[model samples]
Structure formats: C-alpha cells, structure tokens
Target: MPRNYASLADQSVFPSISDLPGDYTCPETGGGVFGCLLVEIVSIERITRLVLRTFDRADSPVTVAFYTGDRGRSIENDPKLKPGNTMAILFPRRHLFLDGTVGVRQEHYGYFKV
Candidate 1:
C-alpha cells in the first residue's frame, strides 16, 4: 500500500491522494477533512499499478480487502460491480472535524475506485 503522510499533512496532492475539495466532510460519520490519504486500488496488470486513492493516512498499515456480493444482499455488495470501479466510504472521527463537535458528531464519505 502507498502512504501519503507528507502530502496529506502538507495539504498537497501527492502519489497517495488527490481531487479532494477544500472543505469536505464524511457523509457517514461527519468527521474531519479527508484528502487522498490512502492508496485504495492497484491495477490488475503485471506491475500492479494503482488507480485509486483512499482517505487513510500514511504510516498507517492498511489492508485492502475484497468482498463478493450474494443476491439481494446490499447495495455495496451488488454482484454487478465492475472492475476499476469506485465506492463511497463513510467513517467517523473523534477529534478534529469539519463540523464543530457538539451534539454534531463527525463523519466522512468519499469514493475509492478499485
């Protein structure tokens, strides 16, 4: 997996993440700003080239797991998923948030192509 700590920390587009908005929030957990902090997918070719970025930060040992969908299971697990496709990720944050912390919890949602 590729890490983008320097780029995420510097708020710049590095090899790790990109195409992030200036002010973005998690659609699910409403957490802090998420940039291209992760390396989501690698190409299926011989070199395993990458095509997607994640919201996870560098220095974080990450794993990319795949799931197969059974009929009538869930929208995400649909069997019609194509190769090099994208999906939305929603996660929560405890500290720094795009929205102020109060009764308002923080969550983030973004697309990761596989």
Candidate 2:
C-alpha cells in the first residue's frame, strides 16, 4: 500500500537505534519508546524474515521477523525489501528477543514503510 507521508510528519519524538535499551520488556508502551527506525537492508531470508543493520553499528545486525499473523504479509510481498534497500520500520513493542535479535511484529501498516 502507498502512504501519504505528509500525514506521517508529526514531530513525535523518535529514538535512534543506539538509544533502544534491552534491559526491559515492552508492556503496552502507552506513550513511551515508540516510533520506527530508518535502517538499511543487510539481507533477506525466506521472503519473510530479514537481517537488518542500523547505521550506528556495522558489527551488529538485527533479525526481523515479519510474521505478525498476515499483518506483515505486505512486507513479504514488497519487492523493494531487498539487500541495500532502506526502509522505515516500527517493531512490535517487544522489540528485543531472547536470542538478542531485534525485530518487528508490526500490526499497523502505517508504521512500516518499504
């Protein structure tokens, strides 16, 4: 789906990739620690998962799982989601995982841009 970026231009405070803390789990963020990150696509896997890299750290790559119960199927179908493409993503509130990979379970299409 196409997006009207004008509507998305609110000055809502967004955290940088380096600012994402892993100490706690996201519990219905209410109004905290929200917003998407601008990241580069490092690699794609199985057409549904992705390995992404933040500009802040080349050594650290985050694995993104896009299986939010068909909520993310559009992401899997997007041709632009390939290596070297840049995209904006709002990960699920629980951005951190047990394996140390950070990713998305985004249920809203508005929060993701391909």
Best by lDDT: 2
TM-score, one value per model: 0.23, 0.56
For residue 76, model 1's alpha carbon misses the true position, in angstroms, by 16
Candidate 1 lDDT for residue 90: 31
Cα lDDT tens digits for candidate 1, 2-112:
774553446343322223322344556533455333333322211232112223334222223222222212333434333344333332222322233211121211233
In the range 10-92, model 2's lDDT, one tens digit per residue, is 42433445555333554466435666655667766654443344342333455555545563554665778777876776642
Residue pairs in candidate 2 whose N, alpha carbon or C atoms collide under 3 angstroms: none
Q: Name model 2 segments beyond 4 Å from true.
A: 1-14, 21-31, 47-59, 90-94
Candidate number of the best TM-score: 2
Lowest-scoring 10 consecutive residues by lDDT in candidate 2? 50-59
lDDT, model 2, position 2: 83
For each candidate, the alpha-carbon lDDT, in order, equals 0.30, 0.54
Stretches > 4 Å off in candidate 1? 1-30, 40-57, 68-110
